[model samples]
Target: MNAGHQTTRRLAAGAGKSICRSCRDSLSRNYASAAAAAVQTEDHVSQHIPPVAQASPQTSYQVNAGVVLSRPPQITRDLHPFESAFFLYQRRLNERSALPFTRYFYYKERTPADREWKRKIKQRLTPARDIGRYKGYGEEAWNDEVLVGAKESDFNWQVERLLEDAETTGVEDQPAQELTETTPSPLAQKKVEHEAVERPMSRITEADKKNDVKSLNRLLQRTLYFLVKNKEGQWMFPQDGLQKETLKEAAHRVLEYSAGVNMNTWIVGNVPIGHYQLDYPTSRKTESGLNELGLKTFFMKARIMAGQANLKENQFGLQDFQWLAKEEVKTQVEDKYWRSIKNMLAER
Candidate 1:
């Protein structure tokens, strides 16, 4: 044989030696792996959900599309002690580094708003953002964990205003000569423009005070997940058997079926974020006599936008339900199941 023919034969031998190593070794994996059917069966066995025998073409899992329905944090999370100190340090650094804000640039020499701004600066002014749900005042600038007691009617702004009103009443109640000394005019209140203090509603709602797990208003500062109790009293996320539809379609159907259509929810994506599997105690047979082995649950994330779940009717198989935080959910769900699913949950 010629030199070129010999080189072609050697190349063929090398190719034969390195053939199908990954196909044979299914345990091997990579983050970049776009693994399809070739790696699927081996991974299933590794998961130990159903026996290796059950991975055959005849045996099958009852595929379920689960909705990890959640209410995102209504308020910012509370800072840790270190975080708070660090932020305070950073603020001081910023204060030292920054040039003094020149009043002449933005404001005329003296006006009501400008005077108010000046008076506020003397008291170390902090402007409040008035966004509807996530709003907070000076002292209430972090989490919305407030005491919804009998005293809830006394919001911070109103309390301060009431004190001011009392002081004004004292001044008004004084004799004419004393009033002359105290006030530029008896209508001193008129001089100040009667700055109205609009009392903001307390963040703590009735649902929070009651510690109602069924209600969505419990934790304003933490993500709340939707869970349903099965007929056996096993608590898990709302899920249903997949029909002849896409995973996302099945997830929507499952959410509506298990939790009712009263809620306005948005599924985060079309694909599953996590996978979990569990096998039945006994190997059951399908209608076609193939082994009905176990369950394979595909979790898809969704956020509750407007309404809440109505499990009162119990129209579906579920008997009880709750909107629980991640830690609370871990306590309720099975250890193995929680282990399979915990990584998908929000840290806080």
Candidate 2:
């Protein structure tokens, strides 16, 4: 009976070992299958991911979201006319200020027809004929005269009149000067002679010259406009301001200054990226904020022209002040950049 019991126990132990071996094999197969499936998933992700260029639209959308939030439509619209006038006036004023007396005199000596045309322009706000209809003057020349001659007061008066007429008539009526074709009167000739006589007998003082240059410069700078295109690509100017010539100089100065500082890459092709990665991070802390670096630079340039070195330096944190204060990093950078520009211009 003892020998039979031992045989049965041995058979039972052998069967138990075989069952354990089969269970271990099944577990190993399941783990291998799971690892293989995970690798396949990883490979699929690597193959399907978009390249940088292809994802540009998404990137653009992200960047523009910030711009849309910070910039109001009215701000852009209001600045356009001011910037255009600023640049236009600056150029003309600079040219006039730089010329020899004889050359300037020759330029002012218009022919009989030219005087008549100018009289017609002064008599009416509306230009009756197309710019091309004028014999000697092209679009550029005509625009220059109209801009330079029409001061801020003149524009204000014209706009006021237009608004008044619009309110009264329920529509704006075109000025009648466009329909009138009057020859230059004797009074116009006499006025021209009087202006010629009033021309400075000696070279203008430095201060006066600087003032004239600044006036025109400011006008041109103020005239710059920002426009947006709709889906159809039609651009509309929405701002109103003085247009001056100095704005071009300011823009050139900015580009040149930026290039000198090894910032040309930022200015040219990669503004959105640079703004996101570099500028946006710093913009959140201040009142004027981070996006105003370009505008700050423009203002600094204007201040320099205005002969307000102390104020200009203060804006850049170059001015020494008592006590502790949080200094703007960009102001410091721009201050250094502009100093380098001044040095370079001096060398030239």
| Per-candidate TM-score against the hidden true structure | 0.61, 0.17
Candidate 2: list runs displaced more than 4 Å.
Answer: 1-316, 320-348
* Error in Å for residue 253 of model 2: 28
**For all the candidates, what are their Cα RMSDs to the real structure?**
17.3, 22.2
Candidate 1, residues 1-348, lDDT tens digits: the string is 443445445555677866465632332333214344546777877788764454477777889888899999987765665554454445434443332556566677766556545444432323221111222345544543322332322334435544454333333244567545555674653634444556545567788899999888778888999999987899999888888999989888888888878999999988899989999998789888778789999999999998878776645678889999999999999999999999999976
Best of the candidates, TM-score: 1
Cα-based RMSD of candidate 1: 17.3
Worst 10 residues of 1 by lDDT: 126-135
Q: Count steric clashes of candidate 2.
A: 49
Backbone clashes for every candidate come to 0, 49
Find the 10 residues in a row with the least total lDDT in model 2.
Answer: 64-73
Quote the lDDT for 301 in model 1. Answer: 92
Candidate 1: pairs in clash: none
